[model samples]
Target: MELPYFITWSKQKAPTTLELSKNSPHAFHIVEGSTYRPHLKKIVDLSSMSYQASFGLRNKMITEAIKKQMSLFSIALPKHTFDLKKEVSLRLIEKAKRYSPQTGKLSKDYKCFYTLSGSEGIENALKMARQLTGKNIILARKKSYHGATMGALSVTGDWRNDEHLLPRQWTVRIPGPEEDPKGEGIERIILKHGSNKIAAFCLETITGGNGVYIPHPLYYKKIQSLANKYKIKIIMDEVVCAVYRTGPFFGIDHYPFLKPDFIVCAKAISGGFFPIGCVLVCNKLSKRYDDKILSCGLTHYAHPLGLSAIKATLDLTEQRSFQKHADEILMILTEFARDLSFRGFKVRHIGHLMAIEIQDKLTIESLIENGIYASIIRENLILAPHLNTPIRLLKSSLKTLNKLLSK
Candidate 1:
């Protein structure tokens, strides 16, 4: 058979059979035996940690989902279809409802909508906000990352998404929580734009991508007060921070007093088993679309297989043992981050998520040599490990990393 060729992210050419490993540096693709070192799939998905599920790997959960899906042989339909209620879609919806904090009496009401990825979920949130409020402008923070799609890219403040930034005039970028921790700039922007003209304020409860930057202690509360006073919907992008990644069901859960109108989530929701994104909205917002038609959907709006994967992943993460493991991992990550800081590395972290500013690309190369798959986001190294990653592996990797830094 003839060999296959592929184009790299940099537009370079290479053979598809190159070593079976080192092909997917971006985590967009997974190469088995190499990506999840020491312990095949176990390392990549250690419970509440990072979920970089690559294709071609079938763990027990994935196999079960596949089996269930094949057995049912259900037709693909829009998730809202009432006729499909008896199928896997209903189970997914019920599971989603259990995960949504907005459904409680004390909290703002919520409804769940499933998407194919984080970007789609974010786009849906923006669309919902604009349609419901009949406003065009959106408020996003500097250094924030919601997703890669046009609508999401337009609102993203980081440079990575700059190439995809189209002329979306409605998104207003404000300084991040680190710069305007008190959210004073948000109020100024709201006033300047005339609150009535603004559809929503989009924010990452804990900013990712640009480095895992935690928000100022009072940031959410201040933004919440501002949004409430002006009747602007608050869209909290918890895509990377939910599903126990940051010690909460939703990242916004960190701020109990604040009530964001929308929550966009993905990643860990399926425990890295499938590509899926979810939008959880307040009851008030859902009512707006109850009679009116929603203006967003994709071909795979809610794939049954994807929903099955989500249900299985949620079941795994919600187990008491998994929760305890996650708690322990958080502690370990906190101490690990502190040690790195003492070693003169600039570290930023919240819960199990962390980012270290390692400016040299060679250090990243060195990390790979040491068998630690570190995610390099711009100038920083994302050091988030799976919740079930062996503690010894982490320590060894850290030691190797520190040695590399010393040199």
Candidate 2:
């Protein structure tokens, strides 16, 4: 059977043998909290996409929240002149404040701008940075994934940007700390191009998708200093690293000194059940648009259903048990990574997000054959299991991974 829709990032238009069985329950289906596939009877998903299972699949709390909101009001609440005050929206804002670095109990130092997806969040952040600074150039790190949109893609430093025929004249690429520890490369670019020409320094809190690369602590300090000196805004892309994926509420929280102008996030915010993205804007930048028209929005900017999901997810995070569970998962992953390293495999991780360096394709194939479902980026196999996965199951999965790696 031929599918009408084009699959993104796939060269093969025709479905493979695995795709053929997608509809069969015995082949590949996720029921309740577990995934089942033909090759791997009960697959353990360690992909970052599995973060949705933070509260487990088909969570009653999130479902009830969405259903309750849907019953009470119109789901599509577009921005209009006579906009009604939404309690869900207000609650979401209050809940989000806890995760923000610039927001405080009595401080009105930040505001949330909602979008439909992480890509939209990035697009809007880029737009606001350029609009606020009146500068065109955007400095982004190499091997980073922001989004698929043109503005976000322009700043992206991977093969995803290679397909575009148009030139990205305004975006500049900077090397990671591994190559330039003191941020000399970024300073050179800023000085050579003139700081006045640059709009923002956009980067992921921890480089995701292109391998989980965590830079040295001083690397963030150096860049923040540069941004301050150059008067350029800092945009921290926490699309994947936010929501306790990195132990901290926000990945940027790990670096207490750096405060970004825009913190863009999505994925796991609404428990991955609803599609929603947010740009948490510092009051310093947002205040400039108080009287002026911000001129950016979407049809479903802050849909009540998404807001409810956000509320439910945030409520779960606020639970004492949830925080303790996250801490436990972090310890488990840290030990798992250490064990892999002791066995001669290169491992990198922060909290539950991890990557194992593998040169042989068979290792990945073997893992998949044995019921481990993970994502591969170049030579790195990403192992980001759901934060709330059972400890027994997680350890069992790790044992299988260790056995396969030993081969």
Candidate 3:
């Protein structure tokens, strides 16, 4: 009999094979005595990714993170609280109150105007800006991914979705300086647009998918200062980079001197246990107008279940200083990259993330075929290892990779 043309084909005679070990609660149907590890399922989830990445390997790491988050979250609420939306919002309301000063801004010192569950949050950000600022054009960086929703897509610069017909408007996508121009070019770009016509300056703290190209250390400080100087509100998009992923509570913490009026965060806020996106606004922007309707709200905003997960995640990082740990992670990563380089795998772990630019596409395919996992980073392979990833396991994976490269 010929083999099946598709991916995997087990022994046809015993196609439904189930071993005695499989029946045991502690074990499952793993290929017996197989030297090479089996391929793990592809991770197509953007939700699982963020500053604090969710589990990738189909193993305990994912389970443990979820279980730990859920345990604290479930304990926080009463049983039978399945509808997590409203409760989640109420929790945010309380959290915001803690941050907002009692008497300050026109927008409630303690109240935020918007909370988007997904991409709609980005759409709402622009909508609110136009409603308040009365400016139609929104400023964004070149090659930005706001969201797929119509309004969010409007200000985006990613060309992958160019064919995707949405109510999109082509606007100014200023070229990021090839050598970190220190915000000189950005200020000139804003001046070019006639600041009165532009509503907001929205950008990522550390550019995502654009090769994790973290801006120069002074980038945000200069940008935030400029937005203030020109009366243009800054909308810092921290969707993938915020929430302790880079070892800081917020990726903005990396640039402590940089103060933005509004900051958008989503991924890792709920620790991959639930959905939660928040827009943290400082008093400066919040005080813009008197009783102006934001005209923005998501039906699932402040979802209780989602909020509970966020609360639990916040609590987990409460005691742990994410910033220090992130710096340490950076150091450890630098060491790993050096080792890979020693064995001849053109590697790069710069910016806030790590990407190994290998010799060719075949090497990537071969790596995935091995037990180790990663994704394409520009023309390289990305390794977004979890905070809990053990170095011993990484070393073991690298040894195998070295052998494969030599072969």
Candidate 4:
């Protein structure tokens, strides 16, 4: 079958390794086989830190799902479909409830719904907020990169957003932490837009693409206070930082006092093993829609295969060693950033994520030349390594970076 001309976000051609996948045998395939040896040796993927989950665990879960024939389904069935009632699905929901940062025990205050991608999670959250509040306006932080879908892109405040035409009703964008140090910008936007007209205030808990910008300690509290006062939904985008990416199971976990009405999570949720995202709604909001049908639905909602992956990912993350490694990686990156700053490389970092924004494209080319592939975002180098990246590998990357920058 011939593939259609689908639009892609990447400016460069697809790598040769992908082309090789076309010729490989599909049955009982082995990932560590000869086909991957050549490609794997040539590149170090520091692009998005999207491969934290071990292949061994991911494949095991997926293989189990296949054996049980749990991968069937076409449309979004009723919430109580037999497939959704399986132990795997129920476990995922329970996992979602128990993962709350505020209270460690099982929670009846929140409900979980799955989607095909992080963008769908964001879109569903917006839909729920608009439905609950009967408002159309959503306030996103400036320079935010939500997703590429029309609905998510409408709320994104980055340069790529210019390519699409979003609705005027959804055009409210607030200043980021740098400009609004105390988080007064949120309140100002709410006041100017009128609380009744705004449906939700959505933002990445720890900004990703623009820079790994961690908000002020009091920021979420201020935003939560204002949202509570006005009855607006607080939507936290944890797609990048959720599932133990930022020293906690969820980025919102760091702000225990502030319970967001909705949390959008994806990338690391299934350990990057499957395409699944979810919007977790707080108990109060979940209750409102208990008898009412949720207008949002996706074909892949609560897929058993994805649920299996989620179950395995959650179990893997619960191991004490994972959190310990997270702490170690955070310290290593922090020291790496400090060292680079002393050497005149402007580095911004939080946890395993870092952004180097010096006035030289040569620095990026130098890293690429050394077989390290970090993405260029806004003319800066963005490095987000897997949480379990070996300390030696990190040191080697830094050594190359240092040698190039000092030239």
Which one is best on lDDT? 2
Candidate lDDT (C-alpha), each: 0.68, 0.76, 0.56, 0.69
Q: Write the per-residue lDDT of candidate 3 for residues 111-175, one digit (tens) a residue.
A: 34435343655766666667777787777777577666787766677664576675545356666
lDDT of 4 by residue, 276-332 (tens): 887888888888887987788876677666666676667666778867876787888
Models, CA RMSD each: 5.3, 4.3, 8.2, 5.2
Sort order, TM-score high to low: 2, 1, 4, 3
Residue-level lDDT tens digits of model 1 in 284-374: 7888777888777788776666777766766667678877866776787788778879988898988777788888744534554454556
Worst 10 residues of 4 by lDDT: 21-30
Error of 4 at 294 (Å): 1.3
What are the models' TM-scores? 0.83, 0.88, 0.70, 0.83
lDDT of 2 by residue, 97-207 (tens): 433345533332467888988889999999999998999999988889888898888888888989995348988888876577667667887899899999998999888
Error of 2 at 183 (Å): 1.8
- The whole-model C-alpha lDDT of candidate 1 against the native structure comes to 0.68
Residue pairs in candidate 2 whose N, alpha carbon or C atoms collide under 3 angstroms: none
Q: List ranges where model 2 is wrong by over 4 Å.
A: 14-40, 50-53, 80-108, 361-365
Q: Which of candidates 2 and 4 reaches a greater lDDT?
A: 2
Q: Candidate 4 — what's its lDDT?
A: 0.69
> Of models 1 and 4, which has the larger lDDT?
4
